[model samples]
Target: MIRKLAFLIILVGLGFAGVGGWQLWHGSVKQHETMKKAQALTVTKKDPVKYKDWDPIKGETIGILYIPRLDKKLGIVEGTSPDQLEKGVGHYKSSALPGKNDQVVLSGHRDTVFRHFGEIQKGDDISVDLPYGTYTYVVDHMKIVDKDDRTIIHSTKPKEELVLTTCYPFSYIGDAPKRYIIYAYPKKK
Candidate 1:
C-alpha cells in the first residue's frame, strides 16, 4: 500500500508539472506572435482633424506598449473586455488615447502578458506606438490602490500621461482586490 501511494503521488506531481510546462510554452508562443504582428504593422499618429472622432472596434489593436526595462512589447487593444484582454493589453475606451494630453489608461493580466510589470522601476521609459506617432513616457511612480479607486481617472492637465494598471499582489492565486498602478509622463526631448 505504501509503494502504491508513493507512485500515485509521483504521477500527480508529474501531471502538474506537465500542465505548467504547457502553459509556459503556449504563452511564449502567443507573445512571440503578437510581437511579430506589431512589428510588421506600421503605425502613424491619428489625423488631428479626426482625432476626437476616432473610435475603434472592440477587439482591434490600437497601439503597442513597449517597456524598455522589461524588454516587453505588447499590443494594446481597443476595449477592456475579457476577449480583448486575452489577446494583449486592453485600452480603456473612455480614456484618452496616446497624445490626448490626459489620462490614457491601459490594463493587462498580471499573470500573463504583464507578468514582468513588477520589474519596472522609476525612470524607466515606456512607449506607446499609435497609428500616427510613437509617444514615450518616463516612469514617475507606482502606487497600489483599492480596485474601486476613482482617483486614477482624474485628469492631470498640461501633461501627456500614461497609466498602466494590473491586479496587485502579482502572484496571488485568487481574485485580487487591489490594483497596481504605474504612472508615467511624456518623455521630454
Candidate 2:
C-alpha cells in the first residue's frame, strides 16, 4: 500500500509541474504578441510628431530596441514601476518620451532581456527605430546609483539626455543596492 501511494503522489506532482510549465509558456507567447502589436506604429495615421512637440505624454510602450555597442536587440517595456513589471516593457508614463530633448528614461531586466548592457562601451551608438523614423543616440556616460534615488527620474536641465536604468552587480541575489544608469545624448542630423 505504501509503495502504491508514493507512486500516485509522484504522478500527481508531475502533472502539476506540466501544467505550470504550460501556463508559463502560454503567458509568454501572449505577452509577446501584445508587445509586438503595441510597437506597431499607430500614430502614422496622424500628423508627424515634431521633435519640438516631444513631451511626457508621448511616452508609450516600445516593441523593439537595438544597441550597437552591446550588440543586443530586444523588446522594451514601459512603466518600470513595480506593478508594470509583469506585463511586457512598460513605458514611463511620466517621463519624457524618446527622441525628446528631456530625459527619455527606460528600464528593463538585466539578466534575461537586455543583459548585453553589461558589455556596453562608451561612445557606442544606440538607436531606437520606431515605426516612424529612426531616433539615434550616442552613449555618453554610464553610472551606477543607489536604488533609492528617485531624483534621477527628473528632467535634466538641457532636456536632451536619455537615461537607461537597471539593477547593478548583474548577478545580485536580492534587491540591488545600486542602479546602473546609462546616459545617452541624442545624435543630431
Candidate 3:
C-alpha cells in the first residue's frame, strides 16, 4: 500500500512538470511565429515610413522591441490578452504608438519574453521597430508599485515616453503582488 501511494505522488509530480514544460514550449513557439511576422513588416527603405492612422486589432503583431543592453528582441503584439501575451510582449491598445508624442505602454510575462527584465538599468537603450519607423528610448528610471496600481498607465501627451512593466520579484513562482515599472524617454538624436 505504501509503495502504491509513493508511486501515485511521483506520478502527480511528473504530470505537473510535464504541463509546465508544455506551456513554456508552446509560448516559445508562438513567440517565434510572432517575431517572424513582425520582422516581415520591417521597412528597409532609405526614407522613413510615415505612421499610419489605424489601430491594430487584438492579437495582431505590431512591431519588434529591441533591448540593446540584453541583446534581446521581442515581438510586440496589439493587446494584453492572455492569447496575445502568450505570443510575445503585449502593447496596451489605448497607448500611443511610436513617435506619437504620447505614452506607450508594454507588458510581458516575467518568466517568458522578459526573463532578463531585471537586468535592464538606467541609461539602457530600448527601441521599437515598426512598419512605419524606428524609435529609440533611453531608460531613465524604475519603480516598484503595487500590482493594483492604476496610475501606471497614464497620458504623457505632448511628450513621448515608454513604459515597460513586468511582475516584480522576478524569482517569484506565482502571480506577483507587485509590479516592476521601467520608465524611458526618447533618445536624443
lDDT of each: 0.83, 0.66, 0.93
**Candidate 2 TM-score versus the reference:** 0.71
Q: What lDDT tens digits, residue by residue, belong to model 2 across residues 1-189?
A: 999999999999999999978865764674566456555643243334543453323334554567876676555555665535444444566676665557777776565445666788778888765544566788888888888988888877566777777888898876878899888888867
Q: Write the per-residue lDDT of candidate 3 for residues 23-88, one digit (tens) a residue.
A: 999999999999999998875623444445758899999899999888999999999989999999
Output the worst ten-in-a-row residue range by lDDT, candidate 2: 51-60
Best by TM-score: 3
Rank the candidate models, highest lDDT first: 3, 1, 2
lDDT, model 3: 0.93
By TM-score: ranked, best first: 3, 1, 2
TM-score per prediction, in order, is 0.80, 0.71, 0.96
Residue-by-residue lDDT tens digits, candidate 1, 60-120? 7776898888888898778888767767888888888877788899999999889978999
Which is the leading candidate under lDDT? Answer: 3
lDDT of 2 at 110: 64
Q: Provide the clashing-pair count of each candidate structure.
A: 6, 10, 0
